[model samples]
Target: MTVLEADRLSADSNRRRDPISSRGAARADTVLAVEGLTVGTGRADLVIDVSLDVRAGETLCLVGESGCGKSLTCLAAMGLTSEPLIRKSGRISFLGQDLSLLRENQLAEIRGRDMAMIFQDATAALNPVRRVGMQIAEVLVVHRGLTWSQAMKQAVELLASVGIPDPAGRANAYPHQLSGGMNQRVMIAMALACRPKLLIADEATTALDVTTQVQILKLMKELQAETGAAMIFVTHDLGVVAEIADRVAVMYSGRVVETATVDDLFERPLHPYTRGLMACRLHATTTSHGRIAAIEGTVPSPSKRPEGCSFRPRCPYASDECMALPALRPIAGIYGADQHRAACHFAEDFARAGS
Candidate 1:
């Protein structure tokens, strides 16, 4: 099926599956809740007030151009932020446990076991000298506490599950021996080794060729369905977003500018930044001589961001009111399983006109 068709179907199916329990009072299935998350260096805040929710069995796509803080938000959520970049202010709860309250060792114990991440560059992320199977088995050994022998056997099986051929033979090979796609599959196997409740894929398919990218995406969806793990898929490609995301959160200049169900965001993008991104997609209708649309200025540097809306300088719709930062608020007259929110002063007006 086409990506758009797949996206629509995925959105419809997701909408049908309520995040709330049968009692219908609360988000009982929420696997990750990140609120007011701000990550920064001593110099300046790089990620500002990002909030996101991913429910069990749902995929929330975080999309934006590079340097928009998509990866930083995920890193902070995973309690994996390193020196110089700390979680400035935020509450990150995974499966009802506040991450900030946990000790480093405690958080480490929970990371590979309960939550895992598939980073963008598998080659860089994987240990170059280690055998692929041993690397995959390491997660099982560390988190599941399986014997080395048992983990190796499961690692081979995991490789097979992710569509790697000659799983047993490949298991003994170093990362350099395999193709980029194979390395990625190995990464997926490792990430899913413990059947984590939340899987964060940061630009996971960004480096693969189109065919390989499609295969990786398909494998991830099938495995996620089988394991029933919530996923936070980060990418700059909206086409990928349509294919995999049930919900999408658009980030611009270190903040979440807009968020909605995949279908709603595509049908009626509220924020100027969101609309610009959609317009940048190369449609079949574009002729040979047609120029591709693009959002004109670069994302502002964190320390040099304009006083008000970080996006206002590049936003075509920006007005004098945009001098003040707009809060990410729900749009009125648009009701659904998920509230549509936009950090734009004219978001309500745009919604009204769209309706």
Candidate 2:
């Protein structure tokens, strides 16, 4: 999607829509609602008390540095978490169905049909030997119960829909033969084959070149608009967020520090970490070489996530009030329209600081 498209949507989106915490009464419009989600091993919590929701036809971008629990959150949402890491507490409801209450057999029925996911690495996600087309056709065969030949025919159409040239020829190509971009497109085709109502993309465009990344983002937007599939797009790159997100959630060390509409976030970032990220983006473009402004410290280790705010150590605005973790609260006076929220004790001060 282009900047113009993003700006138009940002302007048109109802900025007054409340954050998930306040929208419990009207979750009927929500496609995926995650509340108080905690993912961890017995020893430590990797993702703690995180909550966010994706409504019908909207895109919610999860942004943070690596190890901020972005991918783990997606893994938990999709029931793909391994045995070592368990969902310690939380509720993940997709289309009003409680995912935790579903059995493995029942979950399988929804995995590809009602909800689908695209991994960050396309090369590893695709089978090395199987034809790309067959991989997609398999989803249709399993979910739609289409015959082998019928599924194969549909696979070609799916590839074409995602902008792959000579769909029939590319359909038979092996993963090893296609470029990274082609394989990524193949992965998308498989994910969209069933036309899932909810789609989770984990940094889907990170591996491609700029041109291909733009193409893929545009294609995802177009396809999403056509299908009205609510999306949870996990990405650390704010550039992607600007181009695609309707809402943005900033996560810090296993927790969401801020949640706001894309316009609100770019205009007045409340958390220090979020402000630092935007600074980094500006420095990267205004100058070249080694002078880029970056957040001072790495994300805190989950096991030792500090006494108060996890970002306090790196935050320039930290005060004695930050001795305890701040609740994710909506800005005061913005009552009823509880959409913009921040977890910083000094969020109001920062919001008033201005750009």
Candidate 3:
């Protein structure tokens, strides 16, 4: 089925049925909710007051530049952030429990069992020396306490489930022996071993070619439907967001500058950063410029973030009032209520002018 058709089916099913988490079996209406999350070194905050929610079986895409804290936010959610160097504050709720309060051992038990992550560059994420099957089996052995043979069998099944050919043979191959796409399929298999309720895919397709990216995305959507796992997908590609996301959160420098449904975000972007990102798309325009249109200027470094809107320096609409940081405000435009939000001093005016 087409992506839109699949999305419609998923949405309809979500409304009619209540799916429970496979791990804790809590009343799984909300899978993950990150509220007022702050991540930084003890010296200063790198990511501030970022809040987002992923409903059971929904896909919330976090789209931004490389250093916009997209990966950092997800890392914190998974409790994967390196301690001492990285200090995380705020709530990361998974299946209604605050992960920030959990001990490291407890969090590890909950992570793959209740939540999983598909890291970027599957090659780097996988172990070079270990057989792929052994690596995938590790999750099952650790989380499900399966015997070595049983876990290996399950690992092969997981590989096949993600569309890898000859799972039995592939499982025995090392990471270096597999193609980029095949390795990614292995990563997905490993992540799904414990049937986690939440999947944080941090650029899961970044290292693959176009065809492989599509295949991996399709596989992920199928898995999400089969398992009813909520996904928080982090990526720089708007095209991927257009294909996979139910809602879009646009981040800049460390904060979420805008959050809206994918349709609303593209139809009527409320934030300047969102607009700039949308403008960079080459999918819609018949451009012969031989270059992908890019958002001008790099995202400001965390240590040197501007006082005003983080996007103000790159934004064309900056004004004198923009010297101060703009709070995320609700303004009347397109998406109603919680669907539309933007951090800008003259968001309403920008909307009016654009309209």
Best by TM-score: 1
Candidate 3: lDDT of 349? 78
Stretch of 10 with least lDDT, candidate 2: 11-20
* lDDT tens digits by residue: candidate 3, 109-203: 99888899999989888999999999999999998899999999999999999999899999999999999899999999999998888999999
> What lDDT tens digits, residue by residue, belong to model 2 across residues 100-199?
9999999999998999999898999999989999999999999999999999999999999999999999999999999999999999999999999999
| TM-scores of the candidates in the order shown | 0.95, 0.93, 0.90
Task: Return the lDDT, model 1, position 210.
Answer: 86
Rank the models by TM-score, top first.
1, 2, 3
Q: How close is candidate 3 to the true structure, as a TM-score?
A: 0.90
The numbered model that scores best in lDDT is 1
In Å, residue 208's CA in model 2 sits off its true spot by 1.2
Q: Give the Cα error of residue 114 in candidate 2, in Å.
A: 0.8
